[model samples]
Target: MTPVSSPYVPDVSRYTKRESRAVPVGPIQIGGGAPIVIQSMLTSDTMDTGACVREALDLVEAGCELVRITAPTVKDAANLRAIRDELRSRGCPVPLVADIHFKPEAAMEAARWVDKIRINPGNYADRKKFVVRSYTDEEYASAVARLEDAFLPLVHLCQERGIAMRIGTNHGSLSDRILNRYGDTPLGMVESALEYARICRKAGFHRIVFSMKASNPRIMISAYRRLIAVLQELGPDWNYPIHLGVTEAGDGEDGRVKSAVGIGALLADGIGDTIRVSLTEDSVREIPVAEALRALVEEFAGAPRPKEALVPPFDPFSFQRRHSHRWVRNAKVGGGEPVRVAVLEENFAALESASAGTEMVPELGYRPGMAEEVDPEDPATLAELETGAPRLVTVRDGCPYPPLYAFRMLAARIPSRHPILLKDTFFPGEKGDPLRERLNSALQVGALLCDGIGDAVLLRREADPKKALELSYNILQATGNRSFKADFVACPSCGRTLFNLQETTARIRAATGHLKGVKIAVMGCIVNGPGEMADADFGYVGGAPGKVNLYVGKKAVRFNIPQEQAVDSLIALIAEEGKWIDPPRS
Candidate 1:
């Protein structure tokens, strides 16, 4: 099988969940045709059993079916027993998962306590020293054998205990071997997880799930799609429950949108069994967002799927912007320019005063007859692009399919020469529910953006034009298609976190949000900090309880800056790197 099977056909449609093996995590089921499960990680320290128990209970109470706690060390793994006993003694049967990294002994200890053990293949066997070297086939095989030896103990322990395992691969943490071979691409992430899975398959352990997580939605989406393709190629017995997440997704609206874009996009494509929305907020806060995303999936799960032969509209496993013609000749609507944003011309003036010198300005205005209209649902409209001269084309209003699927069809049918004007969400542009608007924009448009579609986005129906403009930019930034200001990808606090993630992320944003095109990562600890924040130009990671580490990309240049001086030092690093810019005059 290839990254994208030419004329690939999935058994399910964009509106259904793909059938997968149901791995039992305690009393709950993850795939094998089960409802999409919602999960979150506890931010409380593992040694603080009371705090862990309280947070786990809060998450379960808020409808989290599964809870994960980080056990970075053997001692932390041992504390899981206390946390579990306390939770179970209090009548809480919510399934617990041990999040393990860089320690096989810790995973073995954790397997004895939790219902499921999630091992990051990137770090479970190999420490990431960012070593870049070539390895011959013999050396690679030896490394794989060593990895198998280290991982099999935990696999056997999980199987013997009749528990489940999650082979969760993080994009930023691929081992030196995989990185040298695949260069941090989605294919590498899938292979990293598969190496461990193949060993489990050999050991006759079928109770397993898999996840390919990255802070970037494009990578996360592509990696999971590639995983599904490989699993299908491996045959029926290899079907495993898949876990989904966009790690280091920051706080509040922006974070939620980032999560929705990645998770909602795949869920809409009939992928993913369990999901976690990692936000830099309270652990319990993540539950509602995950539930909301799951609800969006189930809402369309029953819709009739298309029966025609399905060819992926674009390359499913790559990040190349589709080759759109320079049809909007007068403007930067196509020809590989950054995805443009447009708002209704009438609504733009209303926000004109507020939009000045900020992110509120839209790149183009949606006047009545600015472009040729192409109804995404109509097969005949697709032919119009070829019949006439190449020009800017937008989806006509009232397409029956959801925007995610509809836009995909448009992308599949339209000529490469015709530039697309994405008209997201077919709702009224009136003051109503803001959450609805945000979700629709994120789920519909944000999803497509990550898929390398949509040359320009027009939020025509959003009542608030300023919000429409901001949402458009947020979607673009979240997908790594464009950046209007400093972009943040922060992990939700976990037991492994050494400092206050929520407070620190907010402070970092306040200090540096003005620097356009600069990306900073605010991480709680090293577990996912160095790897997950690989895309950030500068990194602010929690080094210890009261110390912070600053990084330039994956390289940590500063060991431990005092917590109070960390932000200042980070700013200085930015200045030293020549990325610091003065905030605009008010």
Candidate 2:
């Protein structure tokens, strides 16, 4: 399918508009806004000329605008030329890209066969011929520097021979300094690739494409967003073609979902010129998945996104910007305190009862029906919330007919200013029921589009009030906010279990129950549990059923506390740790 140019977008000056020297890959322009091109790689070894040709044909049929084949070794490079020849013989005119690793020789070899070449900075070293994982920052920097130098000759060749060069960064192969400073973050990946792009520009090479590859959807989206932001800031000179993909995305549902989220988010933002939905399964069938993602993104963008859904002004750096608003503490919150939210009924009595003697309205500045209202049940009403606004809604949690259809109607009538909030009981547990399933579907649909919704989220069982409290804390933490009191990370006991992970965790939670922004993890075994709980500020795990190992940031501070006193002992340790924060009042 040909890409339809968007009418409202002003001409982006970031890229050079010269079409004379540019390579036209089917209907898409590589060096221009020439409607985004979709590209995929051939997993088949190039030496298997027939396999390569067959894969290329399949990809082309699946709507792949361009196909890249791996050219890792010199022999593979020759196979690439044969496959390219076979493609032409079979009447498949899809543009071919050569996936090149660090070797300049390999790049130069494939430069003769493929339409485009992707050079990753993660491979090759200055003095050494090659090295895969250079763990040190200096080594990584040197590799990238060397990669830039090696790439110039290839870029020069591309310019001479009329092939495009894509500077790509793989998340798994990131340099030591980048990993140390950024820790598998998209910012680090974008910055690393940009550093190479800068080198290419300095060398006077303009035929460029950039990609930051990761299997994780979040990382992929984050990297692309950062790259676009940087490109926008750099002005027209930095605009180059961008290839989208979830690198090594596993097969089946996982691959599809990862590719959709990563590619979809970028496409909606008007980023990404080409895409590849890298999958582990048959490379032949990968084409349809990529096309599906493209179609889905286009369809989503085709739908009119409400302007009111844009995030409100705030710090631009946060992931919070995607939703278009930042929560700023108001005088009502006082001294920049965290916003306190209550999930209650929406009727006059409930609102009156819940809002009475509380700062929810005052902190947020509300007039009854002043901020636009939507049916708490509507899915569409949940999209595009302003930044930092805590959602408020009412749900008939206990009612049999929770008003699904009515909510849908109310959703369409909702004004953009307000987000939806529903009561907790509306959402059923993981166990399925029709009413519960419908609510979950609505909630997911709303959340997926960046719409905000709230529920006094339910727990598995209410018999143990402690379980409900713990569950609530977990829910708030998942949202990236931790204003809730005490999060307990406990594991389910298995045959390998040594201690009472459930009861012991409960006791610790009870002791620190009043403390907000604190997390305690309880695990079944001492061996892997402590290591897994490294992120927690404090943790305890069963060494044996009666003994426990205590930790603070992965450091084994205390060992083998008896089971009977384990909870109390951990509580005392927490009291000591509490000094790090201002002391809590009685």
Please tell me which predicted candidate would have the highest TM-score against the true structure.
1
RMSD of each: 2.1, 14.0
lDDT of 2 by residue, 1-586 (tens): 1112222122111111222124454335764546556777665556778877887788777777888876767778767788888889888778877776646787888898777788775553223221235367676666667666765777678877767788888665554555555655666677768776777678677778888776545455556656766675666666677777766444433344445555654554456677776654555566766555555444334443332332222222234312212223222221223323332222324444544642222123222442334433345554533343544433333333222222322333344233333323333343444322322332222222221223223222232333333333333343333344554444333323466544555566557755666766666564226433434677787776578887775566888888787776777787787623433544
Candidate 2 local Cα displacement, residue 569, angstroms: 38
In angstroms, the error of model 1 at 578 is 0.6
Instruction: Give the runs in model 1 whose Cα sits over 4 Å from its true position.
Output: 1-13, 304-307, 327-331, 377-380, 429-433
* Displacement of the residue 300 alpha carbon in candidate 1, Å: 2.7
- What does the lDDT come to for candidate 1? 0.82
The residue pairs that clash in candidate 1, if any, are: 20-32, 21-32, 22-32
**Model 1 alpha-carbon miss at residue 113, Å:** 1.3
